[model samples]
Target: MERVEPMPLGGDVARRADAHAAAPLLNCLIREVAQRCPGQGGRRVYRLPGGGRLLRVREGRRPADPEVYTAGAWQRVGHTDLVKLVAEELRRHTGLSNDELPAEMIDSRDAVAALLAARDRVAPPADPYLRSEQSLVTGHPYHPAPKARGGGPVASWLAYAPEAHARFPLVLLAVREDALVEEGDTAALDALGQAPPGYRLLPAHPWQLDLVGGDLAGAFADGRLLRLGTTAFDVWPTAAVRTVHAPAADPAPGADLFLKFSLDVRITNDVRRLWRHDLLKLRRTDTAAAGAIEAQDGPAAWLSDRGYRTAAFAFEELAVLVRDGLGGHVLPGATPLLAAALAEGFDGNPLDGPADPAVWWEAYLRQVVPPVLNAFARHGVVLEAHLQNSLVAVDTGGIPVQALFRDAEGVKLLPDVTRAAGWERLVYCLVVNHLTEVAAALVERHPDHDPWPAARREFARHDVPEIPRLLTSPTLPGKTNLLLRWTGADGADARYLPLPNPLSGP
Candidate 1:
C-alpha cells in the first residue's frame, strides 16, 4: 500500500472548507447569472446581472477568493456571505424565491468541513482506483451545492461518506420469495449472505435503510422481509456516494462488484433514489449500453449493470443494482482511475506528472472519444460519458490505454428521442462536461500545452455526421445547474445555456 497523502486538519479545515464550498458556488453564479466585466487588476471581474453588484475573484478553472464591491471598497465574502449573495442574486435574476438552495449551499460547505476532518483520521485505500473513486471533496465543479448531504445531521451520513474514505458492510436482508422483485443476473447477491428457506438474499445500504425504515416497518413485522446479518466484508463507497465496490473475493468465490443502492439523500441535484421508473427500464438500457460498447473497436468497455434486487413492497427504497467490476474489463497491468478524480486530482494521479502531456492527452482522447461517438452514431446509445461516469485505465507509464463508462440509468437510446436531441446531449456530455474539464486541468498544469487541436483531430477521425458542426459550432450547451435547482426543475430535466466552444476556433 502506498502512503496516504496528508490532509489539512484543525484550524485549516474550516478555512479550506470555505474555499472548497465557494469555488463551485462562485462557478455557478458566474456562469449562470454574472456578466463578464473588465478586470481592474490581475483578478477576473464580473457584474451580477440581477443585483447589479460587481464581483471579482482570482480566476482559474475553479475561481476563488471572491470579493464584492461595496461602498467603494472590495470586501471579501466568506462561504456564508457568498451563499447570501448568490441567493439574493438568484432571487432577483429569476424573479423566484428559493430558501432551500441557500440552506443546501451552507449544508454542502459544512459537509466539506466534516469530510476534511474525518479524512484526516483514516487511511485511504491502497488501490488507486478505490482512492480515485473516494477522492472527490469538491464535487461537481459547476453545481451550486455539490457536497450537500440532504441537509441532515453530519453524524447521520458521515460514516457512509465516500469523501471521508468510509467503508462498511452491507446490511443483508431476505425478502420472501414471492415478494422479491428482481431483473437481469442477480445471482451474485446469494453469495453475499445466506437467506432462510423460502426467502431470497437482498443487500441493503445502511444509510438508505435508515432513511426509509419507517415505511418498511410493515414488511419487517409481516413475513415479507426478514433481517439477515451484514456482509462479512466491507465495501468501499465510490464518488457516486450511494454506489459501493466490493473487492474481489472479499466475501469469497466472486470477483469485485459494484453495488448501487437507493440513497434518499439529495447529493447534488436530486434525491439519489433508484426510482421505480428507472429500475423498470434498467435491463433495456443496460443491454443497449453493454452491446454498444462491446461493438466499439477499441479497448473501451461498459461496466454493465447486471441486475438488481429488492423487496417488492419497498421497491425503489430497498433496490440495489449490481454492476460489473474492473477485473475483466480493465486491461491487465493497467490501473483504472476515475476520470473525475483525475480532473479533481488525487495523490497518485497519472495526470499530475505526465512527461509528454500532448501524447498523454492524445492517448486519452483516443480511448475516450471514439467509444462515445461510436455508441451514439452506430448503436443509437447515448452514454452519460461525463467525468463521474467515465474511468480511464492507464499503463505502467501512466498513459491512458482504455476507457470504461458506467451508470445504466443515465443511458439514453436513440429514436426514443430525436436524433438532434441525442446529438445535443452527446455534445454536452462528451465535449462540455467531460473533455473540457480534463483539458482545463491539463492546461492548468502545463501552461504551454494546448489540448484542443488534438481534440479536433480526434473528432475529425470519427465519421459521425455531427463532427464537422461540433468543431465549427461557436457555442456548446452548458447545463444550467444553478437555474435548474433554483427554479425547482426536475434534476433530470437539463437546461443548457451557451458556453464558448474552444474547439470551434482553429
Candidate 2:
C-alpha cells in the first residue's frame, strides 16, 4: 500500500500573513480559520530555535481540496464566524476570555499565522458565476424566440464584450440593418445577422465602456461625445468633446462645444448653487461697487468685475457634432494662446515668449478682459477663471486676444458666500489652482524670468492689490493667503480688493 505523505505548510500562508497585516478584516479571518482546525499546522516563534527565528505551520488537508489548495479558498471564511472561533480557541488554550488578548495581538504577525492555520481546515465557497442565469448567453447568435423574427437563413450578428463585470456579464451587438435580405421586414429582428456591404460594426473596448453603457448611449443621442482616455475617464468626468480619427480615411471632425460630467454629484451641485447665489448677490449689491472701481482704475478692473456668464441652449442651437476635431486643440496642444503666438512667432515655436507687453496689453484691453467682465457685470455670473478652465486664443500678432472658458460646471459667482469663505474658495480656485498651473507652464517656456514673482506683482498692481497684505500680514478672522505672497506684479505689495489682474493678458 502506498503511504500518503503529510502536507507541509504552503508558502502562500506567509503571503497571506503579510497581506492580513495591511487589512484588519483579513487578520480576523485567519484567527477564525485556526480556531476551526486546531490540529492543523499552527506555530508561533517567540525566540528562534536556530540563529534566525522562523514562524511555521504544519500542513493539513482540507476536506474540499484534499491534496492541493488555493489562497482564494482560504479567503472565503466568514469574518464574524472566524472571530468567534478564534475567541473560543483562545479560551480553551490560554485559560483567558476572548477579550483578554491585547489590542496589539490582533494586529501582530503571530495572530495572522494562527488564523491561516485555521483557514486550511474549512472548505471554499462554490463559484458564484456558476449560479448565474445567463450562462447560455455566450457568443451566440441573437435568435429571438419563434414569434420574434425570421427563423431560416437569418443573417449573423457579431457579439463583442461591451463591458466586464465581476458579478454580471454584458455584451454589445451592432445589428447591421443593411444586411437584411427581407425588405420592409421591420418585424424580422433575426433577419439581420451579418454586417451589410457598406456598413461596419464598431464595439467599444471592454475597459473603455465598462460602467457607462447608458451614458454612452445618451451622449450619442445628445451628440455630446467627447470622452477622456481610458485612465482619466475611469476616475473622473474629464472628457474633451471631439471626433475620433480614422487612419485610412479623412480626419473625423469634432464639435466646438465640450461637456464634462461630474464624478461627485454633491460637489457639482454645491458649485452650481454657489454660482447662482453669488450672481444674485452681485447683481443686487455689487453693481455700483464694480462700476465705481472700474471708473477709478481702468478697463482691467472693470472686466475683472464682470466675469463669465452661463447660458442654457436649446438642442436646436447646436451646429454640427464634428467628430474628433478637439484633439488638435486640447491642452498642451494647439491652445488659443499658443496658436496666436505661433502666428506671430519670431522663431518656429509659438511659445518663444511674447514679443512685447504692448501686444499682450492691447489684446487684454480690447478683447479678453472686457467681455468677461461685461458678462459678469451685466448678467451677474462668473465662469471658472482658472488657467486650465480658460483657453487663450491668440491672433496673427501672437497676442492673446480671446479667452474661452471651458468646464461650465466649475463656474461660480463672486462674493456670494460669507466674505471669508468666499475669498478663500476664490483664491484657492483662481490663484492657487489655476494661476499656479499657468505660471508653471509659462515658467517652463520662459526659463530666464522668475515668472511667478513677476505674475504675482502684476496681479497686485492691476487686479487685486490686497493679496500681498493678506499673505504677509497677520491672519484675519477669515482672511488667507492675501498678504504674505507676492500678489503677482513683483516686489511692490499693497492692500487691495479681490479683482482680476489687468495685465494678465489672456
Which of the numbered candidates is closest to the native, going by highest TM-score?
1
What is candidate 1's lDDT per residue for 1-506, written digit by digit as tens? 11123344577899999999999999998888899988878899999989789999998989999999999999999999999999899888989999899999999998999899888778888889999999999999999999999988887888888898888888989999999889999988898878999999989988888898899888999879988878888888899999999878575644399999998888889889999999999999999999999986788999999988987788889899999988889898999999999889999999888989999999999999999999999999999999999999999999999999999999999898889999899899989989999999999899999999999999998899888888899999999999999999997998899999989866
* Residue-wise C-alpha lDDT for candidate 2, range 149-191, written one tens digit per residue: 1111111101110001111111222323232121111221111
How many clashing residue pairs appear in each of the predictions shown? 0, 46
lDDT agreement of model 2 with the native: 0.29
All candidates' TM-scores? 0.97, 0.31
lDDT at residue 189 of model 1 (Cα atoms): 88
Model 2 stretches with alpha carbons more than 4 Å out: 1-209, 212-255, 261-349, 353-382, 414-416, 444-447, 450-506
The 0-to-1 C-alpha lDDT of every candidate, in the order given, reads 0.90, 0.29
TM-score of 2: 0.31
User: Each model's RMSD to truth, in Å?
Assistant: 2.4, 22.8
Q: After superposition, how far is residue 292 of candidate 2 from its true place, in Å?
A: 17
Worst 10 residues of 1 by lDDT: 1-10
